[model samples]
Each structure stands twice: as structure tokens, then as C-alpha cells.
Target: MTRLTALLLLLIAIPLAAARPTIDAHLHHVNFLHDSDGLETLLDAMDAADIEAAVVLGLPVTKKWEEDAPREPRYYMGDEAPVYYYSAADPLLIAALDALPAAQQRRLYPFMSGFNPTDLNAVEHVRRMIEAYPNRWQGIGEILTRHDDLTALTDGETARANHPALIAVYRLAAQHDLPVLLHSNLTSKRERSFIYLSELEEALAAAPDTRFIWAHAGTSAEIHRHQGALPKLGETVEQLLKRYPNLYVDLSWTVLEPYLLDQEGRPDPDWVALVSRWPQRFVIGSDVVGRFGNLGNIMHSFEPFLAALPSAVADRVARKNVQALLPGQAAMPLDD
Candidate 1:
């Protein structure tokens, strides 16, 4: 090749190589609790996807659904079917972490949650885990919100009640300098119900030091269908994101089809505009439930979303923003 052509090709390649981001902060390595070799599969997927690091989470088995028969204590006591419940200290999690490649191990940060948040002594439990593996685990949340049985553990007042114990957990997170990932959602005919934006504002005021992340952007499938109703909710979320330096949101579950497109099948500019405004406050999360079908779908879906954004903005939303929230950690390449 001519010298001029070679130089031009090199320049283009350099910019393209430097553009890829380096982290996915909202990964869930739950198979560690069940599959003996789950961490291998998790790491393989990361490597395949060119993901540099991921924030892992552990939860009791209550989140799992039984297909054929009863095996363990059912946490969803209502009309919902029985599902097994396990402790956060389940051996699988520790084993998976132990088995990971040292580089991949450095990339994994753990968080703790349970179906019955109140019964688990969340504060004490997370404190112990963080104390034991200070570098391996970083924060806690993804706490269940809808099930009545689990909600009862938080005193039957809904996840937003800020019950004494829940407050204590938040306080503990603050003391540890860790961010709390909340699973608050916007559901109901009214603009707010399960966990209102107002309630979150109050919580932030009460615990200014505690970093907060609204899992799923606080948007649900049902809420997304009523696009007209979201302006108020969006306004509230926008206000919170602007008002609190510690407040953040996750884009993991927020990209449901309805929210991404209108009835006519066109991209919704309003939604895109809202997300773009606070790119720094959002993080990439698959919320991968470990089921093969779910994992495959999430893996396929995120690419288009990434492709839609400007490279600089996507870099922050995909990884850099999360790295900033994680205290004491320098930003790393998403695909390193």
C-alpha cells in the first residue's frame, strides 16, 4: 500500500479502537448461587461481549419460580405460585467468586438483597459481606418490591415506607460509602403509587450522604404503555437527577418496546431526549435473571440501544457513569 493510504488507515483505526467503552456496572452473577460453574459462563459471556467488568449481585432464591413442584419455602404467598427461597450466604456465590479469573475477579463487585428484605437483616448481612470481601463487593440493592409476602417483611407499608430497618440499611450503605440500588417502579393509574417520586425526594433529603440508584429508571412495562402520563413522572425524575448529586438511575429495564417506540412504530423523541439529558446519571444493567431465554434476549437487545446513541454519550451511559458512582475505583475500559 502507498505510504499516504497506510497512514490514513492507521489514523481511522486508532480512533475506532479508542472509542469502545470498558464496563457494565449492573451485571448479576446469580448463577453462582445455583450452578457450580456459573461464574465461568458469566465470565465467558462478558469476554464474548468484550465487557471489561461487571457489578455482580446476589439474592435469595425467592426470585426464582418453580415450574413443576414445590422444593423450598415459597416467598410469594399470595395467588402467585411457589418459589424457592435461599440465604444470601449461599455457598454458590462464594464458590463462583473464588473460581473467577483473577482479572475477571477484579472486575466483579458484589451486592446483596433478598425477597424478604426485612427478615434478612440486610444491614448486618451486607456489612459482613463487604467487610469480608471489601474489594469484591461494592454495594447493595435490586431488593424486591411488588410481592406482598416480601413487602410484609418491610412492615407491609410498601418498599417506599422507609421503615426503620430499611432506613438503617441505607445508613449502613452511607457509612460504607456504597451506593444503594433501589427497585422503585412507576405503576398504577395515578402518576405514582408503589414508590412515588415525592417519597424518593424525601429519602434523599433524609440521607444526603447515601448514594441512590433507581433501578429500571423507575419505569415499568405497564407505565410505559401510557406515554401521556409519563411527562409528570419524567419531570419528577429529571428534577431529582438534577437536584441530588448522589441520585442516579439505571437504564437496564427501561427500554421496553413500548417506551422505545410509539404506536406507529417510530422512535419516541421525547423519551430519547429525556434519557440524553441525564446521560451521566444512567448506567447499563441487564438485570439478567440467569435464565437462558432472558439472558439471550438481553444480550441481543442492548446493541441497538448502544448504536442509537452518540459515541461520547453512550460511553458514559454504558460504563463511565457507573465507574464514577463506585467510590475509589478508577474508570476502566468496558471491553478491557
Candidate 2:
């Protein structure tokens, strides 16, 4: 190749190679069966995806495998067996995090997620977990409240964002300055409006001090599956962000489909504008639920939408925003 051509190619490759690394704000270390591919698998996936860090969560509940069942269920929804609260999830997560080397540990921000949100003792459970682990847990959840099918499938009283038990948990979270990742859907199947939004709003109002990451921005794959795309979701999210300073949106699986990207795979202008306006309040997560094989693809799927955003705003949503949510960690510039 000519010297001029080689020089041009080098200049182009430099920027691409140095592209900012992302922090996956949401990731699960185990599935409903409490199964995992281990921390090593996750680390390799992170390296491949150029992800600098991750907010790793544990599944709060477990799916029951019936002995009479024809085959073992791989997922929570794969069988009719009822799911129930499993407190051991947190310890497993603690064990995994503890097993990692200091460098690998630093890359993972472990959030405790194994308690019944309806039990008043849930507060004590969270407090005890924190006290027991002492400087181990970074945040509180991926708390499964108001989840569509999971709400019905879970073998207990329905879990809601405004549940009394969760209120106490929120207070504890506020006291520790820990962010809570909550999965509360805004609507149910066949509802034309955000029927369940009030439940979330009530919780937000009650815990003004706690940082609540609204998982999937109140969207869910099941809801979309039944009702198709939700209209004006962007506007609703914008309004919520305006109303609550402590509220943050989790841009994950379900929100990506119709809200962030159009059917043609183009970035939606409304979402771009909304996220650009409040970049600091938004963060991206894979929501990959204990799987790492496709982690790279899932993280990179946001590229088009992130690319559509202003460079600064895109950087915040991709990495800095989530890091800043951690207790003492500051969002350092990409160059640093």
C-alpha cells in the first residue's frame, strides 16, 4: 500500500479502536433456576463487548421444577410451576462476587435482590444483608414488583411498587444512598393507558430520596407481546423524569424495540430528543437475565440509537450515568 493510503487507514482505525467502553447498568448473574455460566464467562463477555463495568443483579425468585414434569424447565415461564421468593439468591451473588479477584470485583457492582418485597421484614432482610456483607453490596434490586405475568405466576400476594414492605426497603436504600432497580410495568395487557403508572408514581413520591431505576422505563416484552407498541411512551417517560429528580430510566430489552428504534431499525427521533434532554437520568442495560453468550450483541444493539444521540449525551447513557449512580464512584471522562 502507498504511504498516504496507509496513513489514512491508521487515522481511521485509531478512533474506532479507542471507542469508549460501556458499563452495562443491568445484568443478571443467575437465572430462575439459579443457574449461571459463572463469573469467568461474564468477564470474557465484557472484554469482548468493550464493557468497562456492570451492575450485576441476582434473581430474587426461583422457578419450581415439578417432578412429574415431562422435562426440566430452562426458564421461569417454560413451565406451569409457581415461582417463589428465594432469599438464597443474594448469598450466591455474594459468593460469586467474593470469588472474583479485586480487579474483576471492581468491574462488577453487585446489587442484592433476594427478599419478599411484601413481607414487612423485608426491610430487616435488606438491612441484615447489608450489615452481613459489610461494604459488599452496591445497591438494592431488580426488584420484581408489578411484573405482568410474574405477578400472577409468583406464588404469593401480588407485589406492587407501593407495597408497605417495599416502602421500608426504600427507606433503607435512601439511608445507604443505594440505587434500587425496580421492574414495575406501567400497563397491563389490553390497557389503552398507563393503568399501573399510579403505583409507580406513589412509590416515587414516598421515597423521594432513593434513586429508583425504572427498569425498561415501565415497558416489558410481555406487555408488548400482547398489546403491541405503546404510543406516547416517550412523552410519559419525559414527564416522569421532569417530575422526579431521583427517578432514573433503565433502557433495556423491551424499551429498545418500538420506543428507541423504529421497525426499520432507525433511531426514533422522539426518544433521541428525550434522552438527549436528560442524558444524566438515563442508563443502558442488557437485562440479559443470566446469559452471557449474546452479551456482546445485546450491548452493541444500542449502537444505532446511541450514535443518533449527541456525542456527549450518548456517552452518558452508555457509561458515565450508571457509574455516577454508584455510591462513591464518579463518572470519569472516557479519555481518563
Candidate 3:
């Protein structure tokens, strides 16, 4: 083709490639301090980003603003203060959802994330939240288990995916037909192997009936900050997906740089192939914590990867799969 024709073709393809709608399957409505921009602000962000729906989660842990600190830290990692499990996170989210009308509420799927994953009472807490809200709580998690720095900073016994408490929680999720969105890192910041893989595997095997979305495919920003990337992640994820029929991968921002996108920001061929191989088992998420200003950028960053896949597969990852995992049949009124 001539240079002008190629340029013209590229111009035409850009619009088509960017046209996919999205559902953020792993968004956090409250930050570490249990603060948020409210549901209306999030709705505006979603509209601007072309996001049709979202799985809204609350941070179960909150950072303490110690009196000795120079100034109050707005984020968890701002200081050496220990984080504690904050059960009020759920009520805060519930208040936000209740403030909005039913139509606006449908756009957001709130998951119960306040209880300590290591506490046996966590199972009962999840049950109460679900029963109290009836159809309000769709799933359980963004549950912090085996996280990198966050784990060390949290002021409690470490939460593991396979903890007896979590196994019980997983059973509760299955009973309610709710998908659990879990954040268990595959490996630690220093170790290269899948040290925590078995913990996650145990959880999966313990409650085979429960559906789980492995956040960031078991990776974290802190892990990447230290190790750059997990070795053989695609192969490991594929292996897990093959083994667990209920397993679904959450392709959030942390996986974008080294796993899904190449150095040039183009989609990595291997990931595209894996996603195409099992289209229904994968979904994308913003993973934005308590802030919606960057929501559009976070969602749009996946466009290159989404465009690289077959249209049907791309659509599933971008929008359909997460919707299917949601508990209710509420009408998603996007245009409203």
C-alpha cells in the first residue's frame, strides 16, 4: 500500500480499535483511610471513561495517622504507621450506594471487604453484610492476602488465601453464588518462584464451587517495584486457569506494564493468545483506590491490549465476563 493509503487506514482503524466498552471489575471505592469521592463522582468518571459498570470494593484495612507523624498521611504507605482492619469500610460503602438512586446504584457492584480475612468471625461478618443488604452486596473482596509491603505493614497476623477463615469465607461466597475477588500475590518481593501459589491453590481447591477473580493475576505494584516482574506469569496463569474451572484473572494495572503490554505499549502476543484461548475466564479492572480522577486513564490504558484481541474476546474481557459474575439481574442503565 502507498504511504497515504496506509496512513488513512491507520486513522480508520484507531477509532474502531478504541470503541470497546468497559466494566471495572476491581475498583476500590474507599481508600486506606476509609475516604472516598462518593458515588456521584465515580459515576461521572465512569461516563467519561466509557465504563459501563464497576465492581466497587472497600479497603478492609486503614492506616493510622499517628500523633508523632509530621503530617497526616493520606495513603497507607506514607509512613511507618501500622494498618488495622476497619469493619466500617462496608458501612461507608453502603452509605454511598444508598445516597444514589437505584439507577445509579446498578452501575456499581459493591463487594463486602471490611472483615479481617484471618478472623473466623470474618465468615459471619460477610454473611451479616449480605443478609442485611439483601441484593446490595454482590461479591466478597479485593481481600488483602499475602500482599507485599501491605502485608508487612498491616497490624495483624498475616492473611493468607488458604487461611481457614478465608476457606470458610469462600464457602459462604459459594453458598450465596457470589464471586470472591482476592488479592494474593503469587510470590514475595524477593523470591522469584511462586511461593504463595499453593496458598491460593488451596483456597481454590477448598471451595471449588466458589468463583474467584485473582486480582492483578497475583501481582502487585510493590512486587513489581522490587522484582520488576514475576517470571513466567502467563504460563502460570494459564496453568491455574486450566486447573480451576471457577478461576478468573483480573487484568488490572499492575499486570499492564510487563505482562500484557510490551515495552512499546503494544499488546504482548503471548498474553493475547492466552486470553483468546480462554476468553470467558479473564476480565479487566482499573484497581483505582478511592479516587476517580484517573479512572479514564486507567481504563483506557488497556485499549491497546483490548484492540489486539479478537473483537468477541476483547468485548468479553472488557465488559461481559465481569457482568456475568455479578450476583443480581439489575438493569445496567449506562445511558442514564
TM-score of each: 0.74, 0.92, 0.92
1-336 in candidate 3: lDDT tens per residue? Answer: 422223324444354225468999989987888788878999998887678899999999999999999999988889999999999888888988998989999999889999999898999999888878887788999899999889999987899999999999999898888899999999998999999999999999999989999999999888887878788999999999989998999998888877887765668999999999998888988888888887776677788889999888888889988887887533233322
- Prediction 1 global C-alpha lDDT: 0.59
lDDT of each structure? 0.59, 0.86, 0.86
Runs of candidate 3 with Cα error greater than 4 angstroms are 1-19, 328-336
Pairs in clash, predicted candidate 2: none
Q: What's the ranking of the predictions by TM-score, best on top?
A: 2, 3, 1
Error in Å for residue 132 of model 2 = 0.4
| Ranking of all candidate structures by their lDDT, best first | 2, 3, 1
Across 81-149, the per-residue lDDT of candidate 2 in tens digits comes to 889999999998988888889989999999999999999899999999998998888899999987888
Q: Please provide, for model 1 over 185-225, each residue's C-alpha lDDT reduced to its tens digit, 9 standing for 90 to 100.
A: 55543444544555566667778888887776666544544
Worst 10 residues of 3 by lDDT: 2-11
**Segments in model 1 whose C-alpha atoms lie over 4 Å from true places:** 1-22, 31-37, 61-85, 89-91, 114-116, 119-121, 146-158, 189-195, 222-231, 261-267, 292-300, 330-336
Q: What clash count goes with each model?
A: 7, 0, 0
